[model samples]
Target chain A: MSVVDLSKQVALGIDIGGTNTKFGLVNHRGQILAKGSIPTDQYNTPEEFIDALYKEIQPLIDEHGVEKMIEGIGVGAPNANYYRGTIEQAPNLPWKGVIQFADLMTEKFGQPCKMTNDANAAALGEMMYGAARGMKDFIMITLGTGVGSGIVSGGNLIYGHDGFAGELGHTIVKPGGRKHWSTGSEGSLEAYASATGIAITAKKMRAEFPDSMLNQFPEEAINSKTVHECALKEDPVAIEVFRYTGQKLGEALANFVMFSSPEAILLFGGVIKAGDFILKPAKLHMERNLLPIFRNKVRLVFSELDEADAAILGASALVWEK
Target chain B: MSVVDLSKQVALGIDIGGTNTKFGLVNHRGQILAKGSIPTDQYNTPEEFIDALYKEIQPLIDEHGVEKMIEGIGVGAPNANYYRGTIEQAPNLPWKGVIQFADLMTEKFGQPCKMTNDANAAALGEMMYGAARGMKDFIMITLGTGVGSGIVSGGNLIYGHDGFAGELGHTIVKPGGRKHWSTGSEGSLEAYASATGIAITAKKMRAEFPDSMLNQFPEEAINSKTVHECALKEDPVAIEVFRYTGQKLGEALANFVMFSSPEAILLFGGVIKAGDFILKPAKLHMERNLLPIFRNKVRLVFSELDEADAAILGASALVWEK
Candidate 1:
């Protein structure tokens, strides 16, 4: 639209996972110009990982003819702190202790860098380019290996005193109902609403109904994806499992609505692929549990970002925010 | 202080309740120069109520030499909407339907006016003058006839889409456990943690322990105050009631901390007067339920504002905020 708008400025986005780290060069409009990945497990230390990552991404910047146009870098990583720019005691990361992630990236690339937990990055991405565009208040719930949430209030992500807010998955949904593996707390939302929780539900259901079709799969093989597939085919036990999961998720969501009063809640990650099989019960239970003022007011929808590029896009949004 | 700071500015603070309405002229330093109350049931219509309120407060303004010094008016009432400046279908208020409360105040006072639900007003008061001063992210829980909450995140109160966010009392704590009187939702925080809930616990404990000291009191006479009195006298059933109440409250608070990661949670109103009787168990259970990252970080403290002046102070804070 203008000379400044059309300028060739870009930013690097890196998403660090336990197994692999994906990096990309992205423009202001959330377009990924070039992207690559490196296996994270190969590095013995964070320094080696950073070295390999920089080597792999340097060519992508040159190939895009934006080596000089590079602005900053933004990273989305587990247990990353926006205020401290460190990842502390993240269980999944290879590093044993605290890692000064953003500082390392800044030093390596000679550019400003920011980092936050992955869920918070997803929230920024949704605000900038996806379902939550033009919205100031919303919650992003990632129902993946473990349930995670990012809360946006007054157009800012809520990083509490410790830079570790928005831990909705750990909120107790059922008092003394189920045990959370990590926190050892009972009836946590993660214990009932996460993908792992769904698989656990399948296992419990199979034991309850010995003749159910869910029994055909080995105990360890019954994951959320398989449960979704079975539910799609009208397997009674699988359908019940999703229904139970939605009920728990919906109830917890109602409580979240009462807390921050977000305009909408965007559901992301693997389990949401079940769609209406999960959404239908979630909506029903959420409405049923909501106080009259919040009933029918909050929109519950799935994340619209492409799964493959969402983390990269989300990280890029952080750079643009700066 | 600057010349402008000493300029004798004041705000009219009004706290509207079901039985009585308290009004006061408060200065920027949270000092009440003049205050009074009127029976709320005297007027059948909202216009009549407004007329009476204005007539009563006009003389107080003149008595305090604050006619020209009055900056604005702020009101704390049930079901008040910050965005629309209206009170919608408040069950406790005498009015039958939606009332354009803030607009009416502005018209009558000839000054700026603002309104929010009573709990949110309390949150503003805390931020300005009470325990939450200098703190941006915190939760204020008012433990009274019903459990009310005001959530402050990123230095702003979260008023969700319909202006009815932060209804923590109605958030389900124990699914299928206790039915809330208002929403009929089972096991809401209000069902167990409010003053009324404490009385119900007393009644239930009396029934369970026929020989207990609580059985000496009539069912209708058992209330939070009486229960506290009994606990002070070492009544086992009453002590157990408070313990159970605190356990439920603490667990719910743990969930809240995980959601927003507030710096502190300020407890206000009648039940908090029980002090350590409630706080100890609440703190214990809350810490027990919190994830390790959040454990022992959140301060659970009683409100510092004088009970008689808190509502007025809270309401007045809204004017200063403008």
Candidate 2:
């Protein structure tokens, strides 16, 4: 083996989402050695959660012969802060307070660790391994429970003056409208465009048209995939739902385009699984809404990165970026 | 005068808006020697406009004995490009094609000259002489016939990969619903919030209520000023107009904050002249739309810089920055 190859150490990459905590052993080459996920119990304390993760990962470390070659651990989670290295009361997580998650991982593995918000981690992943691999400027959007965005301009992640920039989801698309959420007051695109939000919108439409084909599925059973399937079958309700969602997304993106003027916005997560169902209208509305200067210039694209592998890759990539 | 003071050369700064072009001669000390204006003729070609500007400005340059002390000229016009040093098909300008405007000024004066988009120049002015003095991160918004924006982040103007990253006015606030004259789409905040847009909306509302007090004025005379007067009197139509415009402005700003997270957003121009009429409602709605992390952290403020003097200071400061 070459000396250059021996010098590179493997990293432990962890992604703690609302439903699962996924992790992998990865090297600088973007190669994964071992990867798996564990259910994230809402009631578990942070300490308990870390212990559970350690139990699952320790065996992988031994299997891969990576004990001494491991350099650090990198983590991505909702409300995680890169600068502070802590998770600050994530809404989805049941934890009530800030948690120094990286430090806990470090304590368990006796290795240095770093962490950042999941959205930012995804951007780092793109920069290191995916569509944005060679590009210096772009924006990444994750359309899951809530819309999350990460901006990369001039090859660096933009943390802003307070390290709190890149809040694209909350950018208003409708100035005065209802969002069907507890936030009360309308106007936010996040109200109707996120995965849960889109599902809610479909549910409400089905209520208004009780006899529509959409009523065949219970509200809880509705998801972006099912919505896309129904729309592909020429279901009018599903088509309308996707069109409306796309319209909102397009408007919000028009605002984003004006701000960053990024090369493209990479879309990922559940809602985007509908693919062109959401993209077609979004492109149409966005093009119509954009200034002539931006006409057909900014691209809306689906992430080329693997969603199943993205979390671990992004988390591992964070260590590489550092 | 001290030797240092005598040796310092001045720069002529001019900001050309749709209504007027404000001029100033500023020395290296950031002091203005003379300030004045001339009405902009919408029918004039780019060359004819330059001739008119020279006629109006020559006497002021002679009056201040500024000819010998002036080192260069700096101009801010709609759609000006700092990189190309030209104004190409500006929306408000009557000109139909690219005008080598900087070259025209340089050929006339035999001095190095610089130019940028009006909004960008105003942003630089704010950084050099106004509320954002010594501050590196802020956004300057011009609320006029159309909403225009200039952004400064990390001590540098955000020119983007192209010199067009800060077009905050074109951001979409309503999804698939309203057409903006600039972009020909429904969604841009500029469609419902610019002074012209506000007037358009008022006209539509007036048609709905023929006997309303707003109809007493000529259609051409409808403006934000008139809207403010009526709103102050609790006129229902005018109140709704301000509320609607303010909400859209606030929502648009929420997107900007997401991308920039600047220290503040500085408001200026004719519409903002209504001050609290536009500011109060915009502030409330902005807070409502901002993410929890940014809530109440960023500020909304009016420009503290003198409008006329600011242009020249900004122009002169460009030389200083170089």
Candidate 3:
């Protein structure tokens, strides 16, 4: 209600990816007022990365005349820990071992900092500004290179005891079936439902149907996008691939529904671009597998967040949580 | 803090079972000062049952001189809904349709009343007075005639969107494996880890090993208790049966851990009396099935509540929750 309060309401959100790190000055309305990026893989040490980020972001703060307005900083990174404010053993990150990310950000920016894994950030983003807004209970699932999930119950994101809960991707859906590439776990949801899994399914289907349209492209050329294009053309092999992936994803979602009874499950990321080609089977199978009490009750929807700004918005929302 | 406050601190807990409905006057310290039960099946209708219950309990209240001390009442019954405060179509209870159990109790006793399914009440009880005291997150499992579960996260019971969350028992552990008599779903945890499941396992093992000690008892006589006793006596057939059951339970628990990542999981009910016989294998398999980050981090323990008083105490704890 005061001018002083309005002047000091912005937050800085940073999303660190394997290649690039995106940063933005975000307002309480989930709007990104200013934004920039730095190459994440270039820095050999986290200290160097933080120094570069501050150098690039400092001018933006001054230009906006809102240096004092930034209340805190929130970061979303691979393998980040909310409890410890550290990123540990991220396979794709440039840094190795554990990095005290939040403490370093706080020291450099002179503000409080909080951090969590990117998927959890996305869930918070949805809860704050996306399709899940105003909803207290839901599951946010990202289907990228590998499957990832963020669980929200009773209007709060579950950080678990160790801050590494909500690993729905790693939950075994098929039992002794396909093996995960990194964890070596068999039948994980990641093994069957991720974009990588979709590509693998396309390859398998191509091999099974020798005369299929997929045969026109070499095996290496096949990806989720290519498969989607082919499926849109009514390619049987590509259509079957999506069907199989949706079936596995739907069954797993049904089990998740039983576990938490979320009001809705939101799908995000690249693979979801296939839309009803994948969603129809996913919803059908999810309902098919659910118990009678849960059938037809849970809504399955797509994320409404603008993909370009979702990460920054999600990370920035964490600052408000403090 | 004051004598009047202390006198009015007590609550009445009621646990309604198929055969017997138990009642107790309890304090905040989880102490049961006075308790009794009435046969649930003797009354033709809920109205008659409520009248009989009040008649039996009013005398105790007068004798304790705490008639005015009881602050509120809480009831735990099968199919009870926490949100709607009703019990619906309980298979074992004499009531066939949706009953306004909470409203009736409030009207009869002239006090506020709350209700939840028996398992959810047990979870609340544990959070207030049992193994889960001081814990913000945990899963409570009761392995009775069938498997039942209650989930707590952020120090609150997860009622989900429909007041029917935490149905881990029905989550499919083995897809299309064993048939659930009630839900008709196959390979549910209830079909593999429940008391009935143990008896089925015993009978199957007896059929396989004709010379086993289990064969000495008629196939109809074999039950969870009998299997535990046989395993204690070093009967290989019974021991194998427990190992198989534990393997299934542990695997299912691992999936649950990935879903919520609770601080600990507490096991209760008649089947858990086997203690190490069941726990050791369950823990081993659960740990074996978990992702490396989660392995050895979650505590698997038995419920510490006295079985005779646990249900009543759990229900009574609900009054304080309001």
Every candidate's DockQ is: 0.79, 0.51, 0.76
* Residues B25-106 of candidate 2: C-alpha lDDT, one tens digit per residue: 7876678877778777554777777777788778988987768778788888888887778887887667768889899887
DockQ of 3: 0.76
Given candidate 2, what's the lDDT at residue A216?
84
> Would you list the rank order by TM-score, best first?
1, 3, 2
lDDT of 2 by residue, A139-202 (tens): 8889988888888876777776676678777666665675637456466667878987888889
Docking class of 1: medium
What is residue B81's positional error in candidate 1, in angstroms? 0.6
Which scores greater on TM-score, model 1 or model 3?
1
Better of 1 and 2 by TM-score: 1
Q: Supply the global lDDT for candidate 1.
A: 0.90
Standalone chain B TM-score for every prediction: 0.97, 0.88, 0.97
Cα lDDT tens digits for candidate 3, A230-274: 898999889999998998899899999998899999999998999
The residue-by-residue lDDT of candidate 1 on A165-209, one tens digit each, is 999999999888888777789999999899989999999998999
What TM-score applies to chain A of candidate 1? 0.97
State iRMS for model 3: 0.9
> lDDT of each model, Cα atoms only?
0.90, 0.80, 0.90
Q: Across residues B171-196, which tens digit of lDDT does each residue of candidate 1 receive? A: 98999888877778899999999998
